[model samples]
Target chain A: MDIQYPLELIGTFMFAISGALAVQDREHDLFGAGFTGFITAIGGGSLRDIILGSYPLVWVGDVWFLYAIFLGILTAFLFHRSLGKLRRTLFLFDTFGIGFFTILGVEKALSLGVQVEIAAIMGMFSAVMGGVIRDTLTNEVPILFRREVYASACLAGAIIYLVLNHFGLDRDPNMLISIGIVIIIRLVAVKYKLSLPRLE
Target chain B: MDIQYPLELIGTFMFAISGALAVQDREHDLFGAGFTGFITAIGGGSLRDIILGSYPLVWVGDVWFLYAIFLGILTAFLFHRSLGKLRRTLFLFDTFGIGFFTILGVEKALSLGVQVEIAAIMGMFSAVMGGVIRDTLTNEVPILFRREVYASACLAGAIIYLVLNHFGLDRDPNMLISIGIVIIIRLVAVKYKLSLPRLE
Candidate 1:
């Protein structure tokens, strides 16, 4: 199996958990958890596909994605884990997820012949908007505009990946390397309490 | 000017207001209200257009859509109204907004060559998902699944509109007449406490 596929599945699971986490406080049954989880897991991809003019949405066409989301939600529900798992050391996974999602989004967009700028925007969106939607659905402030360098971090990763790819790096390897850069940067920042300069 | 254009504007404004009203209990600033209002106003259209493979999102292209959302937020903020001004009739505007949005969504989907069944579904989605997003953002139960015939009413409206068109009504007249029917159905439903049988 290609490593990228596992990376994507892992990312999907992380996101599904994130979604399930939001609904945990509610009196929802497993169905509600799964429903919310499925939306969180695939919502960003769904929007990206729609914006890139891809029909049927990624998860819509691929039943496996749906299965993965439902499975992930149930797993999270029975386990009943907490965000505290990520609270202390979440930097690595969050940054990795963001960077990897950016690469996947850009690759798909370029394949669709979208303009480079638009492709870059899509990549940034792909990385962060899932969490934003999840957070928003949970009635919390979207971390995109607050806590982390969220969208900025994605844009940075996208720029580097695109530049490296243009310089003739193999796409998959460059993606992994670029994703690593994002993960490392984000982890270091979070470890040191780093943040973007606030407008106020 | 096409009278339909005014209808569209009213629909957009009412939709924005519904979004605004959803957030009134929270202490959001102009940006949050505007952003939420914009999403509520056009989320369904954005979804429909994307499902139809429209790129860049309709609001992304028009620019005016954003302006209106900003204006709506400003309007809501300036008035600092709590939806209290029209408490007795707020449901009327909200119901009208949903009906108009649903019919327009159905027409857009059919025009883009979606199958009739899918078009009807898309219409309901476009009409209701914005409210869902708004409610989700506010951490409230989505109005679509509760308290109203909501999406079901949309489905009925779209089917009726399609049937009318199939019977050889002119396009302009068809749109207006169908929109009117939706408005009536929705209003009557609200007035009489009509609702669909729940899945549970």
Candidate 2:
């Protein structure tokens, strides 16, 4: 009854598409696209593992993840033409990935004995870093730093997860609730075009 | 007899300046500039340590590096107008850093029992990643991926270090010779505008 398998696949695919989309119009060659795609798919988790001193890296030890990334790139390349039409689907996938990844990252950090505050930050970072790196590699200021509710949503979810854990919520139910909140918040923000105030 | 202290300082300053210069003309605020500068200064070494399972990170455990980065950012801010005039000096410092960091990274990986080839790649990565990350964060295709002689020179130095080690050369002498070779190659290449052939 591991719901994580499907969630991980969805997250991986979403991140890969985002990465590929960032470079679709940039005149990058196949290698460039693939490289970007791979980094975007694995960058966050790999960074989290490294920071936590976890060895062998996620991709290095798990060939299946590499296959997942390959599938993501192939989907992006084959559907590059119709990708625009799937914007809604893509948004849903992205929001789902963000929620799932934030929870996963936070839980991992906590298991590694990271302080609760640091673990929450790590969770937010894990959910956001892939896109930040993708944008950076494609020559764009990271969208996270913008007024958007993207990173904030992840942080909020992570804090909620911490609070739920403090209240002795079971792990699986806690994760489900935290992820649901993130997805709902993100969907609302996007639907309403909500944004934080920018510095003058 | 520790040459590493001075080399580390020189490398840190050079990377900070490079990062600052990357954003000098951009519309970034002071915090943005400082964050970019700090990332450029420490990004490479932190990554190398993480991959090699080294703990506490170079900057997190020691606060002096934070001071060095601050100094670097301050210098770049103060001398932004004349930074162009000091290109040669900056290049020299950068070259020194590359050589020193390559050796340091390779030695660390070797001590951790990584395979020789992988360790060499780690060396080049440690030397090149800061600039790569800097350019990426600033929204530019990495210059190292261009037909530049940059990464190749680091690889060459790493290979020479491996060869010297295989021949049972003393560690200090081997590091000195390898570093000298990288610095000389970089200087010569820059002086003559030497570059590898680009793919069609």
Candidate 3:
């Protein structure tokens, strides 16, 4: 398997889990659960592909991508009853997923020769925008609007990766460093119940 | 004052009305109503644009689109008490809007050099996918799953446009005939309460 493929798959699972976990308290059945999960995993990449004018979308190019989404959905269904205590765990993985997505998005866009700044925005968008959309659809207040550290954490991670890549840091070490920063920041925030002040 | 702009604006109004109506019974305030209304109107197009790799998602290209969306939302809010009757009126405009979207979508895709078949698919997608998604996000059983003639009408319109363009029709008549066919089919289906067959 190609390295990019595996990284994308891992990121996909985390995204699906994040999506599935959010609907745990709702009265969703298997289909709805799987549907939402599948959407969450692919939604950001799909959006990125579309905006970049990547025809047929990347998921259309790879079968495992779809299969992985389904796997996440099926797993979510089977585990729904037992996973009520995983908000913190989910958040950690979600942050990890966001970091991976940002790195992947920037790499893909840069490979395609988009400007680095636009690619950076795409990276951050690829990380967190799907959740904003999903929440809005579900009539919930999006975390982007209220959860300061979540997307901001992804942006910080994106900037790190971009700076490291520019300075010729080894790819593996750079990825590790960026991912570690995002996960630590997110986990610490969750662990300490840290949040930025809100207006209302 | 392009013709397509007016057509899209009308479609936006129809789209906003349906979204605004969905939340009439929910415990939403004025801001919530406007937000829901805006999402409903543009959400489908946003999805399509993202999928098609279209940038700024059209509405983001011009703030006037948002202004029109706001107007639609305000209109719906003021008339919320009369919505039961408004549904019938909305259906007429919605069906016309559907026709307009299908024709424009196909035409745009064709201009972009997409294959004719994909262009046809994109056309139907542009026309009907928005409403399908809007319903899904709002937790309503999507009209797509219910075997509504909505998509079928768009499909028919797409094929008609494809055939006419194949026969060398100019842009003006090609659009007119295609739009007319879609509108007629949609309005007729609603008037006669017709639907496609379902397995179960």
Query: Which structure among the candidates has the greatest DockQ?
Result: 2
DockQ for every model comes to 0.12, 0.15, 0.11
Cα lDDT of model 2 by residue, B1-200, tens digit: 47677667767877887787778788899888888988888988887777667788878988878888889899888887798798887777778888988988898778877777667767987898887787776776875654247777887899999999999999998999999999988888878987653212
Tens-digit lDDT track of model 2 for A1-200:
37777668768877887787667666565545655777798888878887787787655555567678878887887887788688888888888889999999998899889899989998998898988877777777787976369999999999999999999999999999999999988888888999888779
Which model, 2 or 3, shows the larger TM-score? Answer: 2
RMSD of each: 7.2, 6.9, 7.8
lDDT of 1 at B140: 68
Model 3 earns a TM-score of: 0.59
Q: Candidate 1 vs candidate 2: which has greater lDDT?
A: 2
Off by over 4 Å in 3: A27-31, A86-89, A197-200, B1-46, B53-129, B132-200
lDDT of 3 by residue, B98-182 (tens): 8888888887777766667656667877876666565655576555434346777887899999999999998788888898998
The first chain of model 3 has a TM-score of 0.88
Pairs with backbone N, CA or C atoms under 3 Å apart (clashes), candidate 1: none
How would you encode candidate 1's per-residue C-alpha lDDT over B1-200 as one tens digit per residue? 37766677767776776676566566554445555676788778877776677666766554555556656656666664655577657677776677777777887788788788888888888888888876676566788767566777777888887888879888778767776777787777778998776678
Clashing residue pairs in candidate 2 (N, C-alpha, C atoms within 3 angstroms):
A139-B139
A37-138 per-residue lDDT for model 3 (tens digits): 666777777777766876767765455776677677666766755655676566666777888888888777887889878787788788877787667545
Query: Which candidate should be chosen as best, given lDDT against the real structure?
Result: 2
Worst 10 residues of 2 chain A by lDDT: A26-35
